[model samples]
Target: MPTTINPLRYPGAKRQLVPYISKLLTNNNLAGSTFIEPYAGSAVVGLELLQKGLIKKLVLVEKDVLIYCFWKCVFYHTEDLCKKIEDTLINVDTWIAMKPLRDIINPNDWDILELGFAGLFFNRTNFSGILRANPIGGIKQASKYKIDCRFNKPILISLIKRLSHLRDKVEINWDDAISFMNKAKKDFIREQCFVYFDPPYFGKGEKLYRHFYLSSDHRVLANFVRQNKHFDWLISYDDDPYICGLYSGIGAKYCPFYLDYTVSSGKRSKGKELLISNLPLPPVDLSMTSSQY
Candidate 1:
C-alpha cells in the first residue's frame, strides 16, 4: 500500500498499525470485506484500506462536531476546502485572531463551513495537536508556538488530493460509535464485515482529548461488543491492567503492539499498546516499527 500524507495530527492515530492490520485481514481472507471505523480520529486507517482496495465499502463515524465537519468538507467539497486552508496564513497573529471566531461559532449551524476551517487551523497550529477548550468553551491557546512546524500549503494540498480519491467509496457520519455499530451490524448481515474500534483510552484519553470516554462508558462499550460476536472486530487501547482485565475476562484475545516515537515532553518513548479482538489474530511480534508516513 502506498503512503498517505495526513495533515491532521491526531493523538494516538493508528498509522503505525496499518501494516499489521492489513496483514491480519489478508491472512484471514477479509481484504475485500466491508470496513467500519467507529471512532474515526484521523480516519487514516479506513482511508488507507480504501486506497489499497482492501475493503469493498467504508464507513466512518466521528463524534466530535468540528472533526465531522472537517471530514464532510473533505469528502464533499474537497477543492473549496483545500483552497480555503491554503490561502489562510499560519502565524501567531492569525492564531490569536481565530480565538473569538472559535468562541462565537455555533457548531449546530449547518450552513457554516468555518467550523471546518477553524478545526483545520487549530489542529495544524496547536501545540502537540491538542485541541483543548477553555473554561468559557472556546479553543485554548497553545502555550508555545513553533513557527517552523506550522501548516504549509503543499502538505494540505497533498492530503486533500489523496482524500478526494475515496470520496465515492466512503461514507462519513457524525454519530456515537455504538449507535453506528448497532446499525451497521444489522445492515451488513450478508456480507463479510470488519469493525475496528479506536475509542478513547480509559485513563489517558480523558486528559488529552476534549471529548473522552469515562470508565463507565468503556464498560458499556465492552458489554456491547461482547454481546455482538458476529462481526470481526478489533479494539485498540493503552496497555493498562484494567483494560486488559476487562477484555480478557470476556474471553477476547488480547495481544501487545509496540511503537517507538517521541512524546510531547520532547523525549523519545516506547508505547506498549493492546489489541483486543473478537476473533484470533496472527502471532504477536514484539519488534517495534516506525509509522510509514
Candidate 2:
C-alpha cells in the first residue's frame, strides 16, 4: 500500500498503482509532464504523481457536482472546508443528517458548501467511501468499526491544508470525461501531457458509480481513445471479456494484472484488473493477459 495523501477514501482506489504509473512516466520521458485524469474520482493517482514531482501539474475532470464541489472547496475554500471538518461531529446522528444529500437528484441545484461538506462527511463515514453505500458500522451502529472510523479531524484537516497549497498545480473541471478530453486535446500541449482514464466498472458500473456509462457510452469512450491514439493515454477497467474485447477491437494495447481489492465489508480480496493504453505497456502477467495481435 502506497502512502495515502488524500483525505477521501475511495472504492477501487488506484492509489496503490502510483508506483507503476510513476515508473511508466519516467520510462516514457513523461516525467514532469502535465498529467490529465478524465474520470478523476479521488484523483489519488494524479495527486501522488504531482506531489512526488513525477508530473508538473494535474488536470482532474469530474461530472458529479457534489464531488466537484468537494474538490472546488479543497482547492479554493480551504480554510472554510477545514473549519467544517474541525468542528463537525462524526456520530451516527450527523451521519444520518448527511444521508439526505445523497437523495439530492441534482446536486448542482444545491449549495456548493452544503454539497461539499456533505460529500466529505458521507465519504469519510461510508463503507469503502462509496457515496451511495451505508456508513462503516452500518445504520444500526452495531459493527465494531463504527461511523467515525475513517474520519480523523486532525489528520484530514492537515491533509486538506497540505493539498490546498498545490492549488496552482491542479485544475479541476466539472464536465463529462470524453467532453473534457475533446477540449483538452486542443488546450493542453499534447507532447507535454499524459492522460489516464479510470472509467466506471464494466459490469457493475451502474451500481458502483452514480455517473456510470451505458454500453453505448462505453463504446463512445473506446472510439474516442481509438481516434486519439496519438496522445499518451491509458485506460483502466475491471477484468471482463467485454471490456477487454472493446479496446482490443480498437487496436489498443491491453493487459490484465492482479491487485488486492477491499470491499464494503472491509475485507481485502484479490482480483484481476485490465489496463488498455495507446502507449506501450508490457503485460505484468503474460498468462493472465492476451494481446490484440
Candidate 3:
C-alpha cells in the first residue's frame, strides 16, 4: 500500500507505522469501523485509514491549537487556503512576519482559516518541522535554510485533494486527549469503533513538545484503557522500559517495531518502537525501512 503524505510536518508522527496498522485492522475484520485518534499530531494514521477506505468515519482530536487550526482549514476551507499558500513565497522576511503571528493568534480568538495560513507557512519553513517557543511564549525564529522541497506545489495540491474529500466524513477537534477519549467511548459501540493512540512517548516528548505528557498522565491513560476492556484499541510509543512495564500482562500484546532512516545531514539512524494492541496482530518485520512518502 502506498503511504499518504502528511499535510504538515509534525514531531513523532506515525507515517511509517501506517502499513502495519492497516494490516492489523484488516486481520481483525475492523477495516470498516469508525476510527478515533485522540493524540492526533499530524493525523497521518487517521488520514491514511480514511484514504484507504478502512474507516467509515474519522474523529481526530489534537490538543495543540496551531495543529488543530491547520487541520480545520484543510478540512473546512481547502481551496481558498491552498490558493493562498500556492501564491505566497517563503523567505526570511515572510518567516519574520509569521513568527509574531504565531505567538499572538490564540486559536480561540482568531479565525481558523487565518491560523491555518500561518501554520502552513511556519511549518514549511521551520527547522525539522519542530514547533518551538521562546521563554516568553513567542514562536522561536526558524534557522535560515534553503527553501526547495518543503514548499513543493504539487505536494500541497495533493494534500488539499485528500483533505477536501474528508470535510464531510471527518471531525476535527481541539480537546484534552483523556477527556476526548472518555467522551468518545460513550458515542460509539465498542464492537464498531477502533481507537488508535499515538500519545507523547516517555522521556522524549517533554523536550520536543509543549503539551507533553507526564508519568501520571500515562498512568491515567493506562487505567482507563484497562477498565474499558471491551473497546478495540492500539497505542504506539517509544521503546522505554517504564512504558513496557506499564502495559504488561494487561491482556495486550507488545510488538517491537523498528524504523531505519537518514537524517537531514544524510546520516543513517534506527530506532526501536512499540505497538501495544488489544487485538491479535500479524507478525511485523522489524527490519522494514522507513516510508519516503
Q: Candidate 1 — which pairs collide?
A: none
lDDT of 2 by residue, 76-134 (tens): 99999989888888988998777777766565678877788888888788877778878
Worst 10 residues of 3 by lDDT: 133-142
Question: What's the lDDT for residue 64 in model 1?
Answer: 75
Q: Pick the candidate with the highest TM-score.
A: 2
Per-model lDDT: 0.74, 0.80, 0.74
TM-score of each candidate?
0.88, 0.91, 0.87
| lDDT, residue 197, candidate 3 | 87
Angstrom error at residue 69, model 2: 0.9
Cα RMSD for candidate 1?
3.7
**lDDT of each residue in 162-260, candidate 3, tens digit only:** 678878989998899889878767776644889998888687677666588899898888888888866699998889988888897788888887766
Name the lDDT of candidate 3.
Answer: 0.74
Clash list (residue pairs), candidate 3 = none
Which digits, one per residue and each the tens of the lDDT, describe model 1 over residues 1-293? 22445667665646777777888899888999989899987877878888788898888898877777788888888888888877877666676776665553345764446777777777766655666632111234344435326576677777777888878888988889998778767776778989999999776786667679888888878888888868888898889987876776777888877666545563557767889897787766544544322
Identify the runs in model 1 with alpha carbons over 4 angstroms from their true place.
Answer: 1-3, 100-107, 110-112, 133-148, 285-293
How many backbone clashes are present in model 2?
0
